[model samples]
Target: MKIDENVCWGIIGCGDVTELKSGPAFQKVEDSSLVAVMRRNEEKVKDFAERHHVKKWTTNASEIINDKSINAIYIATPPSTHLQYALQVLKANKNVYLEKPMVLNSIEAKILSDALKQSRSKLTIAHYRRVLPVFLTVKELLESNVIGHVSLAEITIHQSKSANLIAKIADNWRTNPTISGGGYFHDIGPHQIDLMVHYFGEVDTIIAVDLEKNTVSNDVVKGFVQFKNGIQFKGNWDFNAEEDKDNCTIYGMKGTISFSFYGDEIIIFLKGKQERYQFKNPMHVQQPMIEKTVGYFLGKNVNPCSIHEAAVVTQIMDVFCGIN
Candidate 1:
């Protein structure tokens, strides 16, 4: 089915993410409107619909999927249900915008791959950093050779020790492998892997080290990734660390470039000179990408995040976690 002049949207599992970073932005985009929202909690769904001024709310997935008014569906649920919801939407002839950590394992990712191969419907993942202003600048600098030929890069993501301690309680979905796929690594690793893959090509696994957290979580994960172009990536994600930081640094012939994944600060060092750049995030962080998705639905350009690009990250995580 072709996109209509207006891209009406329906959202599934309208949770915390839909509250700030994504929901309102759907209506703010030109030629796009949030027509329907769904969640298991009837009260929450009604509240979200009223707050966002969305026209419809429901507790059943099929209601929105069958609604001819909605041409696109956003799956905002946990990783466990992403594939299940996405297949129904696609089979109903609607485009999809999925939250990251695309699916729990490579097997799920492959099912999505095979489904897309036989359908004309489109899909985009929520790797929003792909279009953020600061990241776009970093991409520009890398392409312009701000740091000669890139050789080695290092990345670290650390959270205060107490964060996990607080989350280890009963029924915390973030720590449950059945629901979250893994702990903080599976949850936050997608952003890092997707961004790295955006700059370089596919990654080959060198080695991965895993450490246990309380029975609920895998607190520490470190790995070495090598790109076909010979660039080396060394990364560590520790949720039980003493400090809270998210940083990535790239080393090259001329100098080094450093920045944070969730922060606005970016620094470049070259030829005895150091330059720093800072910016604020948009009120709704996903607005830019949402606008782009609206454009794609309208056939204005190619999708921002393709299934193939997203699958690579999932494949890497599956291998790293030994999910096979």
Candidate 2:
């Protein structure tokens, strides 16, 4: 069977993520090629192009969006800038691989959803966790009924500091309620919430508490969501923790599944037998996301995480942040 030609990729906001991280993955995926990159700083864009062996570089985001040769665009810009850039790319009729949290709230999420529907441009959110090997294994195990009926789940992500490069990029935008939508809850909650909704189903109700305010507003948030299946998911994010923790525990009638985000390893204890499973990190997590998203855009026989699911996650997050 003859394979279709690789899809040419253009990256908007070529920063640290594009260079040390996702940029390399774009080149690594078999059916995808990094053709062009854009950054406001010409020096950064040039350096990225040279390091990645990309043929084209531009300081203008629109240049990449408008290039007929580029079939897909990745928006790695800050959450604050996601909406405008995404709209421009959609107008240009290019598939979009958007960074996580989709957008600030349901309104922006709705706007982007409408744009995708109207333009019929392929859209995929970069909720990389959904594509991780361990997480995928957990999903499969849950569906396979090794755990019987899932009754409750707890997901916790504890980071020592909130002030990182991405946080700095989002500094002004993150603090401002107008731009960021909310703080850590809006930023990182999408990942955990996506997993919860994916495993369970629609959320019926949610209650949240945010304990901080500032540029990195909401240092901590704890909330519970009731899924349509009557399963309860309790999630917590503590930006002020001393050590980082990214793990989830699911409880069911027959067993429990526990896993961490960093290692892509899962442990299942069912009816007294303990089983541990491990899988290689697929494309460093983020790259597989890009590749799968590209395949979805190219009409290949691969399924990308649904934007409607992401929007629901965002909606749950909005409620968790008390935004609406």
Candidate 3:
């Protein structure tokens, strides 16, 4: 573990997500380079490496894991394969960057947690929102009492069944419980919960939650959760809703703040003086977090996000999904 010239990156699963949501950031960020990439499809790997200008590409993950030049491994595969690839990356004595919802449930989380504890390499999760400028600005706003002392919080995420990323799956791998570990609820639920943890604290209790699934619509989940701060909260995630929406409202003693989960705008309603602040995310949304990870490995900063943090996301999600 030497603080050397630059951090080299090896990406596993150079598929859809890697195209622009993250691929270019390895090179776009300062002092980090995507030296290698791997995918199950040879044609896709070749195209990704060539398009991203990565020096090497391979169909086998072992090639990326074993390459001496690759000091960091980015696991961009599905949730089911996160733990497996993470273990392999750690076993190779390289730092690991894992996808969100670390695993299916608390059971799988414990397995990955134990492996991380045993490994010599460092580990981080891709809760990219934690590094997004919009979220960070909101954190500052809350801390500065922009909305006064915060107390109650409410979240509502509803959308049409067939218009989302998961809906586009060909073989429909995203909704298949066996391959994706759950339906769209489990797939897209992590980003929301993980960000809540960042704003509030650990989820203390899932008071009560209900899950409804049907053939013609997106599944619906309704639940109430309490954070460590005793913040009373209620949230609903319904893919079956007729209206499309993504929103979270935090009510303070003085006022309220509302914003969308995947958008770049925040609205503050303080004393009826409404204000809106907007910030655009980078083309590669993961770049800021990836930059922080590179800095962590270079020994310049603390770890940004951890497997345990993502484990908490899965842990809470399991309760809402009635898994545990």
Clashing pairs in 3: none
TM-score of each: 0.94, 0.89, 0.94
Full-model lDDT for every candidate: 0.85, 0.79, 0.82
The TM-score between candidate 3 and the true structure equals 0.94
Candidate 1 regions exceeding 4 Å error are 1-3, 163-171, 210-216
lDDT of 2 by residue, 112-202 (tens): 8888889967888888877777777888998899889889999887877643413455335555656666665576677778888887888
Task: State which candidate has the highest lDDT.
Answer: 1
Quote model 2's TM-score: 0.89
Candidate 3 regions exceeding 4 Å error are 1-3, 165-167, 212-218
lDDT of 1 at 285: 96
lDDT of 3 by residue, 1-324 (tens): 232578888999988888888889988888888889999989879987887788899999999999988889889888788878888888888998888768767998998889878888998888888889888988888889887778878888887855563447466777777767777877777888887887887778884464554222227777778887877678788876787888899999888989887888999998879999999998889999988988888889988987777887877777777776
| Cα error of candidate 1 at position 213, Å | 8.8
Model 2: weakest 10-residue lDDT segment is 162-171
Residue 25 of model 1, lDDT score: 93
Report how far off residue 239 is in candidate 2 (Å): 1.3
